[model samples]
Every structure is written in structure tokens, then in C-alpha cells.
Target: MWIRALQAVLDRGIRQGRLHVRFPDGRMGSYGPGAGTGPEAQLMITDPALPRRILLNPQMALGEGYMDGGLSFPSDDDLRGFLQIAARSAQSGRLPLPMRLAHGLRVRTKGLMQWNTLHLARRRVQHHYDIPDAFYALFMEEDLQYTCAYFRDDAMTLEAAQAAKMAHIAAKLCLRPGLRVLDIGCGWGGLALYLARAHGVHVTGITLSQVQLEAARSRAAAMGLSDRVAFRLQDYRHVPDRFDRVVSVGMMEHVGVPQYQAYFDKIHGVLAEDGVGLIHFIGRHTPPRVLSPWFQKYIFPGGYAPAFSEVIPRVERAGLVVADLEVWRGHYERTLRHWQQRFRANEPRVRDMFDDRFVRMWWYYLIAAEVSFTDMGMVLFQMQIARRSDAVPRVREYLYPAPGDDQRPSDTA
Candidate 1:
């Protein structure tokens, strides 16, 4: 019964790519279109119980099966290639009636899943970000910008693109000498130090992760900007001072549906009358839905990539004007591809640090994120907001000046 149920899922879910499967009973099966120019992968199942597990919860079981060595790819097509096919197929196919009901139920109960109390928030941040700095250095650039890097062009290196990202945000913030800025959810103080050094502004960065707070403080001290920049182990709700500019990158996803109002309210309260703010976050184009069970259980505990419909109303309630919004469609895909390549290249080092299971988990996490952007209607939103209508320039000429007219740092500061 389980075999037939699993086969039914595979047959319906994989219409575009060809998937060759070897069952535990020594039976060979094939799924997807017989004739197609698409990703072709071979899945070998070693554990007999995996089929029942997959049928019970396909999204969670497949990833767990791969990590536990119960399932593996026999062909050169690795997990990334297979996930690309899976993501595309899921995007094109309609969800079954049961799955649709489950989705609706999840949407209603999303707040419960993402309670994000102050204590729980800290614990959750530590779960994902408290890993050793050396582990991140394996795949990240010199500055350790863990968020999405901007891909200006196809040829831009990760380092260059990260610098460009800071420059872009700096321009949107309307920076000037002596302006006070707040960096909420600052990963490692890269952007804070950049703003202080390049734009001559004072920055106060707040975060919940102890590992990140220490790393950020160390980086600021090393750069001789400790006086200009400070890193605090505090949540956004506790921040006291107002700022001329406020920027949060890749942080809003963790703010959760329940905390959207409080999150924006904190921003609005901390932002001065003439302040300009920018929030860069991953958001979906579709309506609000529950996150994957695998993702919630493994990668990020309290994270939710909100839909714009769920986000905009909160901003309005906070009395902040959405001055400008830009959708970054393929930028994250390129960024993840770079990280994936670098990670696989350093697989030996990663294994030395952890183990094969850890490596596979991280690989799956990165690839699943990449394809989420490519096929699942996920996008990066760079939203420039303000308390007043005229806080920024009337036109967006400041964001993208005429080539050399822009004085913002395009390279590492």
C-alpha cells in the first residue's frame, strides 16, 4: 500500500523531469515523462520503511531520508539538480484536495507556529546562527554577508556583488556625515562598518544571536570603527534611541506573521521624522501559506517568508510610507549557486568540521533555497520606507546616479 501511494506521488509530482527509482524490494520503477529534455536523476532507496514515511509526509521525509542515508542519488545529478526538477514540478502541478485543506488550515494557524516570543526568538536565532564562525567562512565571502548578495551582472564575483549590495542600500538610506543609523538583525556588522567607514555615519547594530553579536563587535574593533559602530545583543523591540536611517536585511522573514505589526511598529517608533529606512527580505508572490515541514523542523524554526499582502497592511498600520519597492527575482538564485559551488568545493573541510550527514543537510538547505527562488515564486524585496512623504528625494535619481556621479563605495570599504 505504501509503495503504491509513494509511486502515485512521484508519478504526479514529477511531470517534467525523469526520475528512475530503485525500491527496497529490488523493484525498478520510473516516474515523469518518458521523453523529455529535462533533469534526469536516479534515486536509490535502501530502507524499506522510507516509502511509508514519504507517503505520510513527502516534504519532510525526503530530506530526512537523504540525510539519514536511507536514500541517495546514484547518478551524477546531485541533490540540487533533482530539487530543481522537484520544485518546478510542484510549481506546475495542482495540490491535491487533502493538501489544499492542510494548506488552508496552516494559514489559519500560522500565528501559533510563529509565536516568536522574546525568549523563543533568541533561542531560535541561536539554533541557526550560533554555529562556529569557521563553518560560515567555508562558503561566505571575506565580509560574511550571510544574506543574499546582489548580482549586478552575470560576471560579478560574490565579493563584488556584496559590496554593490551595501552601496545600493547606502544610497537608499540617503546617508550623510554624522547621521545616526540602526542596523536591525545585523549578521556580522559588515553593513554597519561599511556605513560608518564609507558614509561617515554612526551605526548601532542589534541582534539576538550571541555568536553574531560577538563576531560583529570583533569585526568593528578590527576595523577601528568601534567608536562609530556598536553591536548589541538585544531584540528590536527593546531598542530605545531614534535613528536617521534604519535598515534590516534578511531579517523580516524571522519576524513572523504574528509579529509583523510589532516589528513595523518598532521601526516606526525608532525612526525619526525625516528618516529613511530600507528592509531587504525574502517574500513570496503568492498568498500566505505555511512553510515546508522540513524547513520548520530543520533549517529555520520560526521563519516565514511572508507574502506582500500580509506585509503591506502592517506597514500602513505603522504609518510608514512605502516610498519605493524593488523585486529581486533571480539575484538570490545566483547567490545560492555561488554558495553551493563553494560549499561543495569545501566538502572535505566541512566533513572534517562535522560529518557527512551535516554536509548533506547543508547541501539540501542551500539547494532547496536556490530552487525556491527559481521556481516557487519567492523573491527578494528591497523596500524603502519613510515616516513622511518628502523624507527622500522626489525622484529615484539618487538610487542610481549617472555612472560616475555616484560616490558610494562599489567595492569593499
Candidate 2:
């Protein structure tokens, strides 16, 4: 029964790419090449229990089994390629109705177990970000940007791509000297310090992770910007001042559906009348029904990636205008490719930090994230928001510096 169920899932899910599975005792089967040709993937399941596991829940079993060594890919990177087919099969709506309905009912019938309440939020943030700095240093660029990096060109290095991302945000913001900027969910203070140095903006960065708080503060002091930028280990609700600009990059995803109204309301209360805000986050094409069970259990405890339709209404309800929104495709796919490459290259070092289970989980995390953008409906959202309709220029031309305009760093003091 389990073998038939596994084969049936592959037959329906894979339409374009080839997926071959080798069961124990020398039995083998293949799917795809019946539609179009692209990449082929092979999986070897050494443990007999895995077929039953995959039959119960293919989505969660693939992740859990891979971490447990029950499932094996040809290579570390091959799992990423294989997930591409799986994600496409899942998202393409080509599956039989019963399969779709069964999965839909599963997600729809359940409620999220984790909520980003103050205590839970702190714990969640710490669970993910409090890994030793050396672990992150192994994969991240010099800037240690844990979020998405903007790729200007295919040839740009990770370090260069990350720097361009900061510049891109700065461009959209139209920052001028001495503007007070509030950075919600600031990761390691990278963006905050960049804004202060590049635009002379005074930045107050708030985060829930003590690990990030101390690191960001240490970096600011080392760079002699102790007075210019501040990092606090606090929640967004406790931030005490209104700012001329607000930015929450890669952070709003954690503001679960339950907190959407309050999240935007806090931003609304603290934004200056003429101030504007930008939020960069991972979002889905459809309304998010619930968190991924494996993701919720292993990586982020209380995270929810809002859908376009789900969030805009809440932002509008907060009395903020959605001035402009940009959907970034392919960029995050490229970003994750780099991270995955780095991770696989340094897997030995990471294994030294944690057991093989932890390493496997991180590998799965990187591959899953990369393939989500590449194959699933996951995309990045950079939303430009403001209080008034006329706060920003009528056109995007102003966002681009006028010829010979001084976008350069100066005594912005």
C-alpha cells in the first residue's frame, strides 16, 4: 500500500522532470518524461519505514526522512533540483482533485500551534538566530546578510549583491541627511549601519534576539558609529519614538496573521506624517492557510509568510497607503543558490558545530528555500508605503538620483 501510494504521488506530482526512486530489495520505478524534459532526479530510500512515512505525508516525510538518513539524494545539491519538480507538481494544480483536496483539508482543518506572542516570539527568534556566529560566517558574505540579496547582474559576487541590496533599499527610501529611521527586525544591524553611514540617517534598530542585538551593537561600535546607530533587544511595540522613515526587511513574515493588525498599527503610530516605509519579505501567491508543518517544527517556530491579498487589506486598515509594491522573482533563487553552495562547501565545519541531524536540517532548509522561489509560488515583496498620497513623488523618477546628484556619503550630520 505504501509503495503504491508513493508511486501515485510521483506520477501525479511530476509532470516535466524525471524522478526515479529505488526502494529496498532492488525494486525501482520512474516517473515523468511523459510531459517535457528538463532535469532528472534520483532518490534512494535505504530504510523500509520511509515508504510508509512518505505515504502518510510526502511533504513532511521528505524533510524529516532526509534529516534522519532514511532518504538519500544523489548529492547534496541534487535534492534542490529534485524539490524543484516536487514544488512545481504541488503548485501547478495538475494533481488529481482528491490529492489537492486532501492536502487542502489537512492545512485548512488545522490551526497554527505557534504564535509570535512576546515570549514565544523571543524564543523563536533565538532558536533560529542564536546559532554561533561562526556557523553563519561559514556561508554568509562579509556583511552577514541573512536575508535576501539583490542581484544586479549574474556575475556579481555575494558580497557585492548584498551591498547592492542595501543601496536598492536606500534608493527606494529617498533618504536625506538627518532623517530618523526605524528598522524593525534589524538583523545584525547591517542595514541600519549602512543607512547611517551612507545617508547620515539616525537609525534605531529593534530585534528580539539577544545574539543579534549584541552583535549589531558591537559592529556599530567597531565602526565608530556608536552614536549614529542604536541596536536594542526589544519588541516593535516597545519602540518609543516616531520616525521619519520606517523599514522592516525580511521581518514582517514573523508577524503572524494574528498580529497583522497590531503590527501595522504600531508602524502607523510611529511613522511621521510625511514619512514612508518599505517592507521586504518572503510572501506567497495565495493566501497562507497555515505554516508548513516541517518548517514550523524545525526552523521558524511561529512564522507566517503573508499572501499579497492577505496583507494589503491589513496595511490599508492600519491607515497606511500602499504607494508602490515590487515583486522580486529569481533574485532570491539566485541568493539561495549561493548560500546553498557555501553551506555544502562548509558542511564539514557546520557538522563540527552541531550533529549530522542539525546539518541535514540546515541543508534541507537552504534547498527548500531556493526551490520554493524557483518552482513554487514564493516571491519577495518590497512594499513602499506612506501616510499620505502625495508624500512621495508622483512618479518613480525621483527615486533615481538626478544626474550628478550627491547620493554619496558625506557629513550627513
- Each model's lDDT comes to 0.87, 0.83
**Which regions of candidate 1 fall more than 4 Å away from where they truly are?**
75-78, 92-97, 407-413
Compared with the true structure, what per-residue lDDT tens digits does model 2 show for residues 218-304? 999999999999998899988889999999999987777778888899999999999889999999876575556788889887777
TM-score of candidate 2 on Cα atoms, chains taken together: 0.93
Per-residue alpha-carbon lDDT of candidate 1 for residues 208-244, written as tens digits (9 for 90 to 100): 9899899999998888999999999999999999999
Angstrom error of the Cα, residue 353, model 1: value is 1.4
Give the distance in Å from residue 66's predicted Cα in candidate 2 to where it truly belongs. Answer: 0.6
Clashes of each: 0, 0
